[model samples]
Target: MCVNAGKDKESAQPPGCPVSRPVPAKPAQRPERVSLLSYLLRFRRDILSAQPARLYRAWMAEFRTPFFTSFLCNDPDLVNLVLTERPGDFPKSGRLFEALQPLLGHSIFITNGKEWERQRRIIDPAFESGRIREVFPAMWDAAVAAVGRLEPLADGRPIDIEPQTSHVALDVIFRALFSIPVEDRTASAVFDAFRAHQASRPMINTGSLLPLPRWVPRWRARKTKATARIIRGLIRQLVDERQADLDAGRAPDDLATRIMTTADPQDGSTFSPEEMADQVGIFLLAGHETSAAALAWALYLMALFPDWQARVAQEAEAVIDPGRIYFSTASKLKLARAVFRETMRLYPPVPMYLREAARAERFRARDVPRGAQIIVSPWHLHRHERIWRDPDGFDPTRWDTPEGRESSRRAYIPFSAGARVCPGSAFAMTEGQLILAMILRHYRVALAPGHTPVPVAQLTVRGRDGIRLTLTPRKTETP
Candidate 1:
């Protein structure tokens, strides 16, 4: 999975016994109980460390605040009910809307009911299996570009991989969506603006939990609004040009054109430039940011477990051709896919999901009021003590085990589940596998000595200081 998740605690180890297992790093858990003020302060700092360790074993944990109640559901059945069976009974939370609203606006990420459905109807087609195959060439080029950029940094010097993966992931999205690389000026500007925006946010914003008038300003509103405007403005410019291309019948067959031209079946209407810009903003965040975080952690995990890294590298050396790109190559990356899956198991990019109860309902035999926050934390669920075997151990091969497969079916939700699942799930998986394979094929990553990344989640799970590693060029026969 991820960091060394206290597996030794399960059985008594003779004092001073080496933990033999090479587990990735896990954040230290907070005490079981704390004052509301103390909890608030901790949450403001980092959502992961603000939690109790018992959450790993807990089926459902309730958080009662002065303003609202939050239920963090660790039970897989409960999670399925909330997300899969009865999603309509739990719409997106107000707190979630308040936190991401500035950047997302009415994007499918935050919309509800008919609006969400209509948006999905238009956006979903662009990411279909066939469309993903169409975009694979762009993805391949992005991976090649990323590996080339890292050539200078692959001198065995320590490097923070967060920004490295961020750049590449953003590059991948831009290339796929707009048929332009990240080096393009407008694409670069949007990337920079988005980077600034996410760095300032937590996964959730509890600061605005208090009952305040809409007129009252929340903290960091000015900064968030400013960056959102900058990014959205750049996106609008791109949309205008693409719309012109569409009007002139010279548009590239990319994701942008696909979505902007797809008419709603019910009403023959395509997204206007304004509407397309909003969707682009969502893709920038959900597709680019989350993929970056996961890829960084995946590399960090590779550094921690050299044996697994070597296996992936071996697979890459065998399956990948350094010459012309081929879409068929993605399916052969089984070990790399496993590595990515295990990495997300330990460090899900989007750690916590927040939804609001539509009506009063009983949960775990407890009375849950309507409007209460329903928290489905992939971070906790994936590593639940009762679900996965050696939950915290970094064994990429575990996916082949009975326990792993069963646990995965019951617990895994890195891209979430049901109706609101990430629309680009397939695209992200292919992107991760290709980039990871290409990078490992060219370079070897080792955890930089004296640097231990502490996992934290505000928006997406990432290292506190950053995931640092040393990359050395692989002296292999391949490219």
Candidate 2:
């Protein structure tokens, strides 16, 4: 029998209830089953709203749709086991391949099996630890060039940092790869085409959850073709120039030249013209966009957290000399490195990573059926309650502590993890810290009045309207 509280009829505990306090009545429920389309639509609606992560969590709790299936793996060992331990059993989703095929077309990021191994053999040697220092001069040159361009900005005036960071990142990619500066006309045209392509890449919501044919996206197809033509043409020009040089036995030591000369050990093969175009396309898209997004977010975070910003500035001051910034000095600024790590934790440029079950598998006693699409989102992993202390709070000091270091590396994956992890990860980290340090050496950045940087997950995680900050030159000349 139910018992009402003496004060109010609804406040009393029910008879035979385990707890002394009244059990609240459950909400009324509808008997109707939600269709897959409607469910996907609802999920999309939640993603578009603010607090997308929360929306993602709630959807994952219910059904395991294609979208959620990929996003629901917040468990640590489970993710590790899938991505690192037994990667052979879990490949990138075929659906994802289908979606990006027009743009990427069997690129390293999406391919698997013998083909992926063959590509890795050639690319891995180029990005190994020993060659990193060899590329240092190129990185330094690009950083200095970028900072010089920003020197003309009015002190204490607000500047949109995306374009500034984009220029620097593009410059780095250009100089490192082509051994040439990025021309304004070329940069403008290429960036414009990419922007148009990004916009045309289809609205990623419930629609992405549906298994639809590729030809259904007419506008997207057109944009893809146009973007491919513009960028591929540029890539072809660079490749032809490098190939001609290589054939003449006079190729330079730049990345383009290296890629042209390097052959796969497994197959003793070099990239064909079409294959080279794809590789260059990856470098152009993944290379610049990831770095630019991270640096932009890092700057915005610096402005938002002035204490950390001040610490970074102080570290830069100690390491960088007046009138000149050196790449070797970047090694001495550990605090700045920690702050960059924390910023990445708070705002990873890429949010979701997708994989598919190649065959039936078991993960922690749960059956992962064959063909099950799996998603591992850094967005959720970085913020999971069990993985971090004060997960929601912005605290750079957390990274300095031993617990923070272990926890972060285990949970924090701004560049992702496993075999398919971004090859440009180290290059990006070095570039980001160096650029941030160089920029702070010259100017103090603060959030502009009435400006709020809102995080949005687009092709990359970026500020919805761009990060705007006030840049003021430091007073007192130190010669």
- TM-score of candidate 2 on Cα atoms, chains taken together: 0.84
Candidate 1: tens digits of C-alpha lDDT, residues 1-479 = 22333443424555555555566899999999899999998998899999999999999999998887889999999999999999999998877777777777788898899988899899998988888889999899998889899999999999999989999999999999999999999999988898788776777677667656667877765776798789888989999999999999999998999899899998878887877888998898888889999999999988887778899999999999888788999999999999999988999999988899999989999989988899999999988999998888787778898978989999999998999999899999999988999999999999898999999985688899989999999986544
lDDT of 2: 0.69
Q: Poorest 10 consecutive residues of model 1 by lDDT?
A: 1-10
For model 1 the TM-score comes to 0.95
Off by over 4 Å in 2: 1-62, 65-71, 184-188, 202-209, 212-221, 322-327, 476-479
- The candidate that achieves the highest TM-score relative to the unseen native structure: 1
lDDT of 1 at 318: 92
Give the Cα error of residue 144 in candidate 1, in Å: 0.5
Summed backbone clashes in each candidate are 6, 2
